[model samples]
Target: MKEKIKKNKERGIITMEKQRLRKNKGITLIALVITIIVLLILAGVSIAMLTGNNGILSQAQNAKKRTDIASEKEAVSLAYTTAYAKNNGEGKVTYSQMQDALDDNGTNAEASGNIIVYFPDSERYYTVKDGVVEGPFEEKPETELSAVEMFENGQNCDKQDGTCTNETHLHIGDYVNYEEPTSGEPCVIGPSQTGVENYQVYSLENNDLNWRVLGIEEENGEKRLKLVADSPVKRTGVRETEEGETITEGVGPYFDIYGAEGYLYAPDAMDAISQIFKNDDAYEARSMNINDINQALGKTTDEQIKEKNFLTMQGFIQYKESYGPFEGQWTPEDWLKQNRPTSIVSGEVSAYAYLIDNGSLPSELSGIATTVENERLRSMLFDNVEPETGKAYWLASRGVYALSGDSYASFGSGVVTSEDGITVAGVGDYAFNSNGYEFGRSGYAAVRPVVILNSDVLIEKIEDQPDSWQ
Candidate 1:
């Protein structure tokens, strides 16, 4: 058994039993080490591949950028195509023209810039500049213009920019820009430079009245519009009765329905400008004057005048009510009541009554330049000149009457204007007849109308529209 164990002796002497040489196991160990080294190298290479600039995260980001840019470019191209198709036959879009359309619903801007941008909504936008379809802007501007804002952007236009113009040759009935609703009397609504089809015309009850621009005024740092009748209204009445009387039907201290305040109470101007209000049979007839429209300006009701937003009643009457040209004293209301039928002396003239001669509520009323005491009705004249012809028109001041000691308050009377530069009033004086009846009237004169406008309403002139000659 001992002889069985063999060992391979190298060059040494051989033993009885050769020891088998132990084959070196070092080779296998070496092979294992080599394999571990190779595995380590592979791990290092994998980490580098995941974290490099051209790795997965980077590729994903690039894909997103490409998608977004393509989407934007497509949208910008679409906008231009659509605009051009509807561009009213203009071959190419100019930067200014495009901007004008974007800035305003109406456009006429013509410039040389190549960029045209439109910000549709807070989050939607596009820019067209330098002939490049730059973006469908991911972010929008902070402030935006309103629907009406663009319409009101021009200053007093001395020249036509397709929006506002200086309007050097405004006719009597020419439409002017009124940045607010108007009050006072309305102009006759009809075919004109500003078409009735374009803007809504204000109406009283049912019928239309003439409403026109008078002038622009400043109030609380904002502009206000002044309006008046384009022409003298046709009506009739006399200047005096059988004898000279201060206490009269046609005059104020208004015991009769013909008083200034009474214009709305009843259709006192029946012969002058009274029409039927179908809804109310009891008050079937009403006066379609400035006072009536003024009273109905802001009511919650759904009447025609209220819907128009045409104007606002003027409330500033600073000057003391007095007679124009002549200096005298004639008290109103209580004092006149205390005095009785003969209380008003023949010589005493009221400045308030004299206001009838006012053609317009002036920066200081021009034309007859008379004064009025009516808190309701404002007298207006065409400044002695015809609205279209520049010819002088007539006006009214104090009405003449006769004191017949008629307790029925029935006396003959008529309105009259002071003889001077010009006068504005109803052509005929509204007076009482000999029968002591209110209609006991006579004579014919022109009716000049006046009105006031509310702030913030725009009255833009239409381009290419010509003035309607009177």
Candidate 2:
């Protein structure tokens, strides 16, 4: 019996040991499964972090690129406007001209930078690198007066025996010298009439005609005359009267008079006057008076025209007292009073201040950076970025006519948070683009900077806000 009891106990101990071993094995299997799952989760997270839209590396690259492009654009714009202002009305400077300037000055493209000026009339943009011109924007059509017309305009002339002849008829007061004469007297031709103040003379040498006045000389209280032609000149009639009277009838009777050689017709001045009146009236219409040209250029004086510049949002506000009225709204008698800087987003305090100071935001600000359809975004950006506080806000909703033409519309509400947890709201889209606005050619485009502010401060502002405001 004693032996049987000991054996039973040993059997119990063995069974217990086996049970313990089985439990350990089960625990090990469970731990292995959990470890596999945890590793899978970690792998998934790693992939998402590297490939997500907001991945750190990608965002950093985009930000860097944006900043670089903005800087480049700003440099280009400053150079162009400065160059234009310096060289206005000197005739359009082709790209090659700019390139030559840069090349002569030894400008460094990578460091000193370059500019490209665009002349729309020439349909070309001149590329200026390191202050040197590179390329013309595009070829332009050559438009010039024809040779015949130019010649007829008195570009051609010839002299024979102290007489000047041109394809176009001659008028009195026209000065002529014989090509053969080394230093002889100049022939002064008298008009058909004394009162004939102006006349058109055709150049027979170059087949051109020009207008001239009669050369009047008073010697001892007696008026003397000179003729473009010397001796008995034969006159041809290009145009005759109805009665077949030669238009040149009373023009001249060439002779050496008062020691001055040439033909003089003091008594027939009235005939010259009559012939001028008989000519077609088209010449009167084709002429451009000085007043017309001045009018076409808008204002002649620099003081009459308004000046503009691209400034930062803060800078615009600082100078708001000087801006003009809103575009298409009203003109100020004192332009300084009426002009004001405005943002796409209404109620942007900074923009209001800027408009009040600068008069107007750049026209390019409306659509140069982005399409005109996104004006609303621009407006929203302005409204959210508050001044002094330096915070930006964004809105959740969209509105109608959010963009006017190519300008962005200001709408919605949101705040931009700073890295240090400070929050200011009501910024606009064009705030950053405005900085870049003046840096490029007239039609050049730029990207706006995304608003950045303190995130912690943003959350706090939202939490502290009333439910109604939200």
Candidate 3:
């Protein structure tokens, strides 16, 4: 309602007015929004309680707890029954003798809450812990098992209850090749089946194996280990020597404990590896072959680099000082006549001396001969056995003589036969009578190829062992 006042005359009647003020009521828009949000929050909390990871409804639907307990109980009953049956229906049955019967293979049934009762006589039992099925954790495995049981002699890994034993590192003196156990066949337990491919190679650094490639040169008409594809470690090849003898030689997991080389050689990739076999290089230390060549010292500063330039991953190498090639092992004229040994780098000792001092002695000669004569480094260098492959593997030391001729200046000094006969069977009597060489080339042999990892090559083991060289 409004009250109005009327004017008496034209001047006073112009301004009579009515004014009213109303009370604001009900909830504001903001308050209404807040109420709706509160309701949604409560609804979500209730829903989550009904269906989240630990919700009562979720647990009820799992069905695992019930089924696991039942399965486990059944396994236990089976073990008990089997043990009782063995008692011949007459003697008192005890679970003690059933230990082996209920080991990992018998007890794991993907169950839970079912308790295990290991009879005192039971030496082994299975257990399902942390959702993993494991058993026979109680005792050591018997060693008398057959090769098949041990994942050998063509046993499939999936066929065994236990996994194929993971392959371990092969040590120096192992003579394994792809076709060792039987000719043209992969060894029973080498690169063929074992997943372990790369082997650690080294030289006697600080009396331990240090890394060095003998020298880039052709042997058996094949290249040495290189960064290119088809690693020598995986190749199935035969070592044909100068004396017309063929022997077991091919690329397989080899260890050069002195060189710090690692190979990722495996059976499947044997024929198709990525690393190329360029040639052998024997210098312990040298300037990059890319540098100038030194004739007097027989340094292949230029030629050696061109040959080893195939290096890929290990390219992180830097320049080092030149050392060795004491001299006159092979004549420079000999290399020129045959047309090879384009690059000659030297080492601290002749290949012969290195073999005598560092090579792993053959099992037969371990106690009999401490050092084979220099000329006999080839004939006397015997193969070592690889327990896994059950065969002898070749060493990098090819049975060749280091030429000793003071006459050819630097090239002849310490030159070893590149491919055959410890002496020059082809080069005439001038090789043995005048040159003083030994051993007719007899056979091909496995080479423990090596490469030095850059000092920066980071590895977990290297980091863990700070005193590694020590």
Candidate 4:
């Protein structure tokens, strides 16, 4: 019986050892399979990234190529336009002509393919090969000649007879105006204000005239006409105070010279003016105020100016003034008044007093008008003023002051102005003062050197929001 028990124990031990070995082998196999699967996934990802057309690397390359092409095309177009202008409305230029001009202007002019130049007026396009001008071919249907047009053989109509044998006369684009009578109207021909300034008149015989037309003129040309039909007169006012002295006071002869129409939002304009003061480097001016504001006229103001915490309008008025019988130009009376108030309570009175005093007031207030006639002042205010006839002005607050709800302390709301002082427009967003505790929310981000008024009240105003008071 002892021998049988010992044999049974030995068998049990051997079986247990075999089972442990089998379990270890199964785990090893499973782990190897998992590792192989992970490796396969990584390989697939790598292949796709390397070969895919829209991969990250390919997209970046394509974007760079597109930008390079656009820049090259612009450079080529500018070169052509400059060459055309230099030649006085005569002589057709081929691509070689343009390429030589560009090279002279320090630009690369190596022709990559067959270079063609199109003239819209003659409807002629000339090709350049081996530095020689070739056939003036008819424009291809698929080719877009936006800046000019080209015609070959003048097949559409007879140039000498001024008549179209085919439907060319009736089918010609809307370039002809039958309403503009040729008699006594003095065929007002030259440059069509916007584009190429070549205009020639052909007497339409038998209802046909082969007039070559070029599209609109180039926008930024040095030799473009600067003729203005009418300009608005800027006026100044002289009011005698109780102390007895002639003082220039009152609003404007606000003119819409550049066809500036619609309501002028005083507060919004003031905010823009403030930004002009803050970014004198961008505007190439010194400060904010009417003068600096004027220098930046015709250009869009900075987007940061709209943050109503920086500027506002004070009042609207009809301004009128005269210098002398010989020198005074008739002035308009409607003016949108503005003020940067230390406090809303006394801001209006202070601004009015400053304007009325005209540099004769106490030292505190006299700083406002010391440099009214300076070149910097005129450049800042008069040069860039874009006032429409029927626009509104707004009142804004500056410095450390608390504003009402939805009203920003720095730049306030815009309001409408009629002939009479009427607040027709609603207050702008964030167009109120901010509380003192919220200085961080109300103050400007940086100190900008700005002209605060027409006088010498130019100073650096702090623009930042603080977390807590000292």
Candidate 5:
């Protein structure tokens, strides 16, 4: 019985030991789970602090940017003050002075015109007006301004009344109403005259001239729009006699009057144009040259006649027979060869005739207009105008023409367009007919002014008109 009691005590001791071991294991498992949860929570918080819009790193970067901007602003301010003192306390500083002051501070800056200055360090732009600095903000790219854009933006009209269309598109040949300013210097015509002291001062202010778009052309590395008046503005001879008759007395032999140093783009005409634009330098006014007229007529220079066969013996014979009752003997072939096609517009055939034939003329000059388009172009350029009013309009160009059969040539002569045709005027032509020949037969012409708008000049509005050429 004592041996059984001892065995029971032993069994009880083993059960207690097993229970203690299980409790310790449970405690260890619980501690391990708590430690993992704590680590995960700390990791999430650390991630949140390091990233996103309001993170610690973002705040630090923003603060650094702000500091840099402040430093740049201080530098610009110091430069301005230095420049102001150097200018004897003047309210404004010149562009060079401002640049020099900025350079002295070891700060690099860029300028746009005489206005805005850009700082590269802070990527900020500032305006220096009257020697005062005004900005420390990020710079925005400037929008490119154009004539069509300005018109479509309704800059000149009251949009509330719907007098303007925001989608209006501008094109060549469209009419525009540009009023000459009323307060500028008066335009002086022929300020200095030879043999006589005669000049005219014209005030074109407040005049809304109906100008037609000739097209866009590039002048001096800038694009500009060209416009021509619909009619002659004034009637005057290129070189007028005392009695108001046109003459070419002192013009050098050959056509020297319409060249670079001649009547082409006359200085008097250009000076008058400049005076008209004294209040607004963006607009340039001048007399239309021959090439300008050719462009308006949808023709190009050096293309009016074929270069190879234009003044050939066969072509000359055909031209004379087609357009003349020839009484003068035809010149020798050697003479014809020596004085071949000499000018941009070559051939005995009229420009109108060449256009009608589509620049393809047969040896017999029997080519007919294949389409009515040529006739229309001819009428638009030369015909369909009042004979008296549209008689002679001067084109600032030199012209050369030689008759095949006679000692006839017109050189250094003013090119004029008239109801008769485009011919050399001011300098006379030496021509002989079946009856007789005439020499130095000069005529008078009026001025047709053209206006050129610089690329940067913004137009406020354009009048709506049907395209007549179409």
Candidate 6:
């Protein structure tokens, strides 16, 4: 009996021990699962922090870049300030001076002509002119625009709907506005019938729509903009005499009395140009000259004109050599200084031929060819004419022409006139009572003003019906 009791006790102990082992194993499994879940959560958070957008790594890198750029800009500013101070408050700083200033600021830079380049980046540079710093230079466009292109694109035309009728591109023959001159008032010499006192009058009412682009001219080794008026500032014409005969008035008799020499340097031409501006050194306004006409027509050549039958086309063969300073001849070195005639009565056939070829000639003024359809061309060529009156416009030029095929030389004033509803580009003159014989050329004209702009002149665009340029 004792032995059986002992065996039962041992079996019970074994069963209890097995239950304890099972409970401990379950607790260990639960603990293992919780540890694995916590590890996975931690790993996911670490990846997001390191590799996702706006991660710590990215933020750190961005911070570094920003710091570097700021440092660079600060260095540039410091260098510029130092250089400017060294320049005695002058706006300009030399390339060498800028380099020295940069060195002082602990920034290495190189000098290239008027440009100073940052040693670290070639794209960064600054332009300097005569010891003046123009400021930081950005990378220029791969295709730099030409001067003509700037004029075309920078025009002040409204493009709200992307359609512009009035030329968006400001070019030759386009109207440009400017401030009226406050001083050096221009004298308008009217017809003799208006009296000499009235001839010296100045009216500001006639200046509207007067300014137009003449074309480009070379001044001081740089291309400059030239502006001309649509009509003359003065009126010069013939007055009926007591005997019912017409005679040239205003500066016409000067051509007869003083000859071509005096007319070339006549006060009418010189004073008219000078009095339009306020005597500003930056602006040079003058009377339109023959050379201006020639230049606008692409400086045509004699061969080209002959090939096109310009003289035959215009029925001006007899007066072929009536205009002076033909193509490839002497041009005035200093128009303001030249006191003598630079050219004799020679033919500039190219100008007329170009008009015919381009169909720029007026239907009534030009020969049996197409009329000028382009408004710009019309403004350029015939805008100065008072076609109804057959009055010509004076040019700052002079010539000598024959009087009715006579041996006696007669003086002529350069003019762009209309005769019998035809355009006449030649000289003007008046009848002289020389040796009691009435023998001289007769013409009536006025003065058209021109302005040569300074190289640095700014063309401002206005929003009015006729845009202004200053």
Candidate number achieving the greatest lDDT relative to the actual structure: 6
Worst 10 residues of 2 by lDDT: 453-462
For all predicted structures, in order, the TM-scores are 0.28, 0.18, 0.21, 0.20, 0.46, 0.48
Q: After superposition, how far is residue 293 of candidate 4 from its true place, in Å?
A: 59
* Candidate order, lDDT descending: 6, 5, 1, 4, 2, 3
Off by over 4 Å in 5: 1-56, 59-145, 148-167, 191-201, 205-208, 235-283, 298-301, 304-388, 405-409, 412-416, 420-443, 464-470
In terms of lDDT, model 4 sits at: 0.29
Segments in model 1 whose C-alpha atoms lie over 4 Å from true places: 1-173, 176-210, 217-222, 232-451, 462-470
lDDT tens per residue, model 5, 221-305: 4456666655545322235445967553322111111222222224356335434632342446776565565554444534432
lDDT per residue (tens digit) for residues 149-263 in model 2: 2223432344211144443322232322212112222122233311122221221221112222112222343222211111111122232444865354322211111100001
Candidate 4 per-residue lDDT over residues 72-100, each given as its tens digit: 55555666666567655333333444756
Candidate 6 residue-wise lDDT, 249-346, digit = tens: 44331211232223434435344543554223224677776677656544355553344333344343323344433323222222223463333334
RMSD versus native structure for model 4: 28.7
Pairs in clash, predicted candidate 6:
92-131, 92-132, 93-131, 93-132, 94-131, 177-469
Query: Which candidate has the highest TM-score of all?
Result: 6
lDDT of each: 0.32, 0.27, 0.27, 0.29, 0.46, 0.48
Candidate 3: residue 454 lDDT (0-100): 17
Q: What is the lDDT of residue 176 in candidate 5?
A: 62
Off by over 4 Å in 4: 1-42, 77-99, 103-152, 155-163, 167-470
Model 5 pairs whose backbones collide: 254-411, 255-411, 255-412, 256-412
Candidate 1, residue 414: lDDT: 24
Q: Report how far off residue 11 is in candidate 3 (Å).
A: 33
On the 0 to 100 scale, the lDDT of residue 202 in model 3 is: 16
Candidate 6 Cα misplacement greater than 4 A, ranges:
1-132, 140-149, 152-168, 185-209, 235-262, 267-275, 278-283, 304-373, 387-391, 403-405, 428-443, 461-470
lDDT of 5 at 318: 30
Model 6's lDDT to the true fold?
Answer: 0.48
